[model samples]
Target: MTETVVANPFEQAQAGRPTGPLVQGFEVIIGFETHAQLSTESKIFSRASTAFGAEPNTQACAVDLALPGTLPVMNKGAVERAIKLGLALGSHIAPRSVFARKNYFYPDLPKGYQISQFEIPVVQGGTVSFFVGDELKSVRLVRAHLEEDAGKSLHENFIGQSGIDLNRAGTPLLEIVTEPDMRSTAEAVAYAKELHKIVTWIGICDGNMQEGSFRCDANVSVRRPGEPLGTRREIKNLNSFRFMQQAIDYEIRWQIGEIEDGRKIQQATVLFDPDTGETRAMRTKEDAADYRYFPDPDLPPLAIAQEWIDRVKAGMPELPRAMAERYVRDHGLSEYDAAQLTQSVALARYFDEAVSKGATPKLASNWITGEIARRLNAQEIGIEAAPVKASQLGQLIARISDGTIPNSAARVVFDALWSGEGSEVDAIIAAKDLKPMNDTGALEKIIDGVLATNQKNIDEYRAGKDKAFNALVGQVMKASQGKANPAQVNALLKAKLG
Candidate 1:
């Protein structure tokens, strides 16, 4: 039997309506399940080393191998770390939560059931707010739980198949789940990057995408507002920001096309083909029943006191958003400028360092955001390794702002300082004779010379050619060998020419 689709334009128009705000292209409803590998020396439940790049099984212990007579024990550092992350995210630590044995059989699971959290988690109820082009869109956190990671599989050449690397087998991971609050591919990427920053800023996760320190699985579906949700597709293990965008974009288009063609979307686990930029089904999606989650009897409940939470909370540094807001409110910097400066933790800390060294906040922000960032990118160096010291850079800005050196010539000082060849900003400026000629008599001499050389431009200036004055100003800059203050040149040139 053929089902007749409704032909109402009003309904159809909204049927293809995008997710979220329209300004972001289409509404994309995204809920991210991010797994960040915790920075711990050992696995969550074993004494196995969690360090990367050891001989494949060198880090495995008897507990890791599931040998007889060995009972699982929780790592204290992993628990403390979960609490630290929860507090940083403003989450509630469940007073008591039990670990569950997530039963699954694979080449990687030594005991055929991985120990993880199921019904009760380490943390519940938190929010992660992210910005999308000046519009703040918040994604609420459902829960964050601590779990042990499975061993990694390496498909190497053994004439047929690859070997396993259990070095990462017992590494701890924090799984952070979010409500389906995102509406576009752009928004999803933005949220992921912000979360990456927060995790790295809190010093819990390293945010190393290549090493799988940070990973996100995005659940995407299409739905008509006020209508039931379409069958959602789960795209898993999307590691990079670009891949996340690619996976979601392809998934959304595929779903929309499938619905339009009257085909039902099947829920399943899928992997992204980075080379082809498409999503492919890996397995029929596993439900909780498939995992057969049950409380683990091997380990007792982990405990945390309020004092520990307070101590962890007090130890967190200023976060990115808060630091950006403070820069704007206290330093008179624009919100856009402040965000750019605070986008990286290193840059933000460097900016604060310069401020403490007596640099004007506005000017310091401009130099760091505009000039310093551009230079660093060009040189392929990070802010922490910048050749221009904060003190030296601060002195350069102060000299320019305080009329010690001509503003136009400061660019030269900056380049020289950045090259690591210059002594000090002041010494370089003086040796190069780049001082601002604030003396009226000295400026008058250059102004007189420009008027004489640009006779035709002077005539044009008087003939209602307002822009001709700009040419005369150029002549003054040239006569002064580009060392003159442009603002002073403009004013002095206009007065003398008139």
Candidate 2:
């Protein structure tokens, strides 16, 4: 007997919307379900420590174990964190939300059923906006619900037998679900990254993928542009952003191949093997009905008052989107530059401090996003750990703005400062003799010598060749031992040629 495939609710909600760009003549529809572990110190329904890396089963209390006569109690901190997320995403926080038992039998789930929100979640109808290589894309959010995490099934260190770790059981989690709004792998990855940033920025989750503080499950499907949505296969527990992209791309190709070969796509849960760079089915995916969801009898309904939400809003930090807009509005930065600067709180604060110290906003942005970012990534460190402080960078930019040193010379000072060769920006400039040649007479003489020797380039320049003009400028700079200011060289050369 054939099983009935349940249609994705997001696809139905987005019907008649323009289909995304096609891959192999079929459009891809993708959605996400991300579990962000809240930063609370205890489990959602118990007081067990939520700290990671504890010995297996040591942290599981009687409540987590679902012992007979044990009652589940709600954690107020978990609820506040949920409210923070809803406010950050501009989602609707339901005044009354219900917790239902998702009935399943897994060794890790000691309760035989997991408590999660089904019919009425805490957050609803939000949007996650991000940039996909300069073009802005916004993915609609379905809901973000409060839930308790299940324990882990450890397959390693056991011969032909798996071990269950209940230490992670009952940990507080906010499972954020997104609509089928992503069309390509790039968009999906960008959406995930933006969501991760929001959660981490607001201090609700640690956003640590390696430690399992945050995880993503991708639902990917493909269909003809005008046809109804195809059955989707979910790629489970993608921890790394790179792996997430790889998994989704491979799944899209695999689904298209199956449809072309006259086979129907099956709804299942698949896992990506990084060793082989492929996705293999783990098990058949279950629909909501299969879980037999029902409200839990032990726990009462969660009802949040407006006054409590207001208090959370009052204590919230400046959100990334708002901060980005402020950068663009007050500092005259491009949207892309602002977005890049606001990627993290530390980076954004560094930029702000540099600007506050009188560095030109545009120059500080270019240096921070270019050289500083490159160095940070190469060393695998954050902006807070940079050898050169914000004040030092601000001084460096000031030198460039005042024409005391060219950008090329400023970089030499930057290297000296970054490598601990010099402590002060001006001291490095003085010690390395990196100050640009400021004498107008000396610059004119250098230009004269360049023009007399490079007559071919001069002729080419007069014949409307822009490259030749640049070549003459290069010769003048080289003759000046690379200490000539680029703007001065250009102006002097143009005056002499005319």
Best by TM-score: 2
Model 1, 239: alpha-carbon shift in Å?
2.4
Error of 2 at 286 (Å): 0.4
| lDDT per residue (tens digit) for residues 1-498 in model 1 | 221211211111234424564322324456788999998888888877787778788998888888889888888888888897787678888767778899998887788888888777888877787777877777767788889888878786666886876777778999888877778888889889988988888888888998899989998877655565556678998889999999999988887777768888898888999999999999888777889888899878766778888887788788787888898899998777777777778888788888777689988988887888888889878999999888887888888778777767988898899787695887898888898666778888989877877788989899989889888887788888877788888888777766
Residue 271 C-alpha lDDT in model 1: 93
Stretch of 10 with least lDDT, candidate 1: 3-12
Clashing pairs in 1: 18-27, 19-27, 19-28, 20-27, 27-183, 28-183, 28-184, 29-183, 30-182, 156-162
Q: Write the per-residue lDDT of candidate 2 for residues 1-498, one digit (tens) a residue.
A: 221222335447566555678999999999999999999999999999999898899999999999998889999999999999999999888888888999999999999999998888888778888998888788888888899999999999999999999999999999999889899999899999999999999999999999999999999999887777789999999999999999999999999999999999989999999988899999999998899999988878788899999999999999999999998999899999999999999989899888887699999999999999999999999999999999999888988888888878888899998999988888888888888888999988888888888999999999999999999988988888789989878888888888
Residue 259, candidate 2: how far off, in angstroms? 0.8
- Runs in model 2 deviating more than 4 A are 1-13
Q: Residue-pair clashes per candidate, as listed?
A: 10, 0
Worst 10 residues of 2 by lDDT: 1-10
